[model samples]
Target: MDFLRHVKNILHTYWIGFVCLIYQVLWRPKELKDLQQHNGCVAIVTGGDGDIGMETVRALCRHGMHVIIGVKEETNGQSVEAAIKATCPFAKLDCLPLDLASFASIQKFVQQFKAKGLPLHVLVNNAGIMHAPFAPTASSSGSLESHLGINYLGHFVLTRLLLDMLKRSGTKERCARIVNVSSAVHAISTIDSIKEIQFSKFYCPYGAYGQSKLAVTLGTYELDRRLRDAEFPITVNCLHPGLADTNLFRHLSPVLQPVKNLCAWLGFMWTPSQGARTPVFLSLSEEVEHTSGKYFDNCQAVPSSPSSYDVRLQKELWNWSCEITQLPCDIQDEINIHYT
Candidate 1:
């Protein structure tokens, strides 16, 4: 049975790769222009030192928005900030240390940002690990699987912490945005029980990564629903950044790494800048300014996996996330009262 599951997983991965190649051949990557500039608006992008995240930060900086990059290392954050400022001399940028694997670090990063008294206009949860070796985050409640912890839970806590600020910063005319960088592989993931989310005794690298991304997608939709129900002017959405040839593949075996690079060089994968396009578009495009709770690819709304839309699954994940994170079970109620 385990062998069958592994075979299925491999097939799914190859199928997605084949589909991405077709997408690259059939469509030209779109460019966004004349983005409306918000000189004082602040945006936070996690993993800003990475290929796609850095490009997203660069695009935002070019448009006059203040960008705060959340990095695991202070030096990496500073390096990215300096690189951007070199090109855009007036770019407003700050780097804060953020390690998503650690809840205390996430909370500290939020507190530090709050100290700056800046309003968050956009948040790009762009940090993720793919097919990494098995490891678990040492959490207060218990250990969390690394992929789920960093990719979904950490961002989950950070967003909840900043929800009030995003609410206050947004108005009817301009809603604050939350862009989660999910993946096409999420469609193949399943979360039928809490065990699937918290910890699985049997671990498969791609399986773990896919389940985490699926959680991200599920959380995106659930949070958007709650915000909209409360009439809050905040948009929550997630997207697939295409198969970009970024260091995300650094986990691959050394023998397979060159083959991956060769495929990328041969036009089978997107460059980091190309992967940044849809995220940048979602962040700044007037087209989706009010769009919420949708999944996107290549700058267009596309239906996500059928399971992703299951209200039961969405709420289950939301409730479980709150329980594990030690947040109030009825968080939306808290937000509503805080706004009132």
Candidate 2:
């Protein structure tokens, strides 16, 4: 049975990759434009120092938003801020140190942001590791596989910590936005049980990466449902930025690197600017002002993996995430009390 599951996963990964390649080759995704300026609005983008994340920050800054970049290293954050300011002298930006692998670091980052007394209009969970070597976070909450720890759980904790600020910043006319950068690879992942979600016995790098992305998608849907039910003025959405030619592929094996390079040469992969379109769209477009609980690609709402839509699975993951992250099991109650 395990062998069969592995075969299925491999097939799914290749099939999705093929389809994305064809789509990018056949049609160019449109750039986001003509959106009204976001003056006075504040946004946070995790991993804003990365290739795609840097482009995302640039786009938001170009729209006149005050963007706070969350970086693992303070120097990287400062560098990114300086680089953007060099071009757009009017760009309002700040750098905050954030290490998603550590719960303590995530908490500290939030406290520092709160100290500024700024309202968060958009939160982009953009940082992730793909096909990384097996390394677990030394978090006090509990050791988690690096992909799951930094990719999914860290963003989960960050979002929960800042929920109140998001609520206060949003209004009926325009809702606050949460943009989670998920991937089509999530379709290949399975999380039927808690044990599978936490730690797989035998880890395949691709499988681990896919599982973390699946977790992000599942949590996006579940949180959207909860926030909507509670009448919170925030919109939660996830997207698959088309497979871009980014540093994300640095971990690929030598055997796969040649194939990846060939794809980039053939124009099968997206540029960082192309990859940033959907995320930027979700963050600023009036078209999605009230859109929630949907997965997007190429700036359009599309269905995610069949498993991602499993309501029971979504709730289970949400509950377990709350337990592991030490958040209130009933987050709605916390939000409600804040509003009252």
Candidate 3:
């Protein structure tokens, strides 16, 4: 009965929802003109290799912002930096080798940034992989789960590492927006262990991916609360990038490959450019500063399913993240981890 009622509610909102979805996908705006004069801003986009991340770097370069493009490997990462320099000669762009599955890489990347002594104007957690079978990383002691470890755990650690730089950015000009590129799939995800790391467990690839995204959204909510209490000047927000046709989906098991391709062909999954627009919006939009702790889809604030707003869920996820990352589980640590 409950499921039927839920389906009926979605149907009731179906037409208007479809209209909003179409407008968001079809005619969504870009920051082409407004991004200019972003001279001192240092923006970072993870997964800056082929699809949405690359497009985001393009937008930042055109706006004259210095961008740090983060990728998993030096070879694949450096290529994007070179491409940016070629097209946008005035655009200052560098590359960071970030393995979203590894903690050492994230720490090393942060150390390099701190060495520069420059304020980070923006941090975009844009890298993500989908539907991969179980695989753990060097830093992860968790069970054999790729999506949970990389998609969620990776950014949670990286964001915490970079929070000081972000605080510096907030003090300078715009209260920086830490944009976590989340997904609609989160609505389908739930954590099995919301307070501790689990290992060697049976895994569901898609469910794990969704769970990580749910963590991402929960992390954002937790961030909002922490920053508010700290009186921090920065804004933290999240969004579902919509399904984009990117290499990120190469993880689909062979059996599900056809269905994934079909979604792209049918326009259910978006193009890279389309998928990247909302991140760009959160990064540069004038209106978003006023709306924090919100998850956006199609450039508008929308409820992120009932689970996302559950404070208990957010805390449990946050605590679990801290334990997995082995970070200090202090109030300050929790606050810093969430907001940045």
Candidate 4:
């Protein structure tokens, strides 16, 4: 087997793999015949202006899915949209403003989307800020670091905002897919300093980045459980798009530039096109139709770090995330939620 594929065995305990394999035996991809009218199915992608996000746009377009590229700005996003249209002229695409760092922006975008009166089929929470300096935002949950605030908290709010739209899709098995983009570095992440999720005044760049990714992964598990209990139609899953050569690291310490360059030179890194394959495959794959609450890599289901599966931590991070977003979370006392 390819070394990259071997990573799957390393990720999941043997039992989880068996369960996934059995569930996938009857799996089916989303049917495209009905989505043609662009009435019931639409994909909303955050940070879709460039890099891996753009490649996802291309994939969705190729499959004839109407897509919305959510970005921090319209003009810049439009240029990317035009570029996408240049190749797939039939691509139904729109660019919307979405600053994940702002709670208001998150709410506003969802509200606008609802006004479109279209059922949202997939929400690819693809936007995130990485390795930036410590800064505070409404999504900070009293934390000084921007990594968790933007990467995890922002998507938290946005997903909450669109939950209704996701439910309305009403596919027979699952209504919609909420795919949160996480990272491979999650193997090194932990939420031990639970205090840091809030009042993160003391910051370590790597820790904060890892924590943010961990939070996204953990959130997927919690959301998956919640959906199951509520018997909701949506399926929640998260995946790591193996280190892509996107602009995500421009703000990292200058030394990282050389490190990134060296990694790419040595083939340890992937170009945005290569990195996008998993997310695109996850979004388009029929094999995963029955899969939920799992972390994936290279288009296949894999086990995330043990910390990511802890229900307690998942709950903690979910609460901390909601606190930061100041959004209402309907999690109940009866449900068991935690971080792995």
* Candidate 4 Cα errors over 4 Å, as ranges: 1-40, 138-144, 198-201, 331-340
Give the Å error, residue 316, model 4.
2.1
lDDT: the better of candidates 3 and 4: 3
Instruction: Estimate the overall C-alpha local distance difference test score of candidate 2.
Output: 0.89
Q: State the C-alpha lDDT per candidate.
A: 0.87, 0.89, 0.74, 0.72
Prediction-by-prediction clash tally: 0, 0, 1, 17
RMSD of 3: 5.3
Per-model RMSD to reference: 3.0, 3.0, 5.3, 8.7
Question: Which candidate leads the pack in lDDT?
Answer: 2
lDDT by residue (tens digit), candidate 3, 197-312: 23233445555566677888988999889877776767889997765678976865588679768767877667888878888888887777656899988677888868788898
Of candidate 2, the 10-residue stretch with the lowest lDDT total is: 331-340
* CA shift of 311, model 2, Å: 0.3
lDDT of 4 at 134: 69
Per-candidate TM-score against the hidden true structure: 0.95, 0.95, 0.84, 0.82
Judged by lDDT relative to the true structure, which candidate is superior, 2 or 4?
Answer: 2
Instruction: Please list all clashing residue pairs in model 1, or write none if there are none.
Output: none
- On the 0 to 100 scale, the lDDT of residue 5 in model 1 is 66
Model 4 residue 335 distance off true place after TM-score fit, in angstroms = 19
**Prediction 1 global C-alpha lDDT:** 0.87
User: What digit string (tens of lDDT, one per residue) describes model 2 on residues 154-270?
Assistant: 999899989989999999899999999999999988777766875456666777788999999999999999998889999999999998999999988798899999998888899
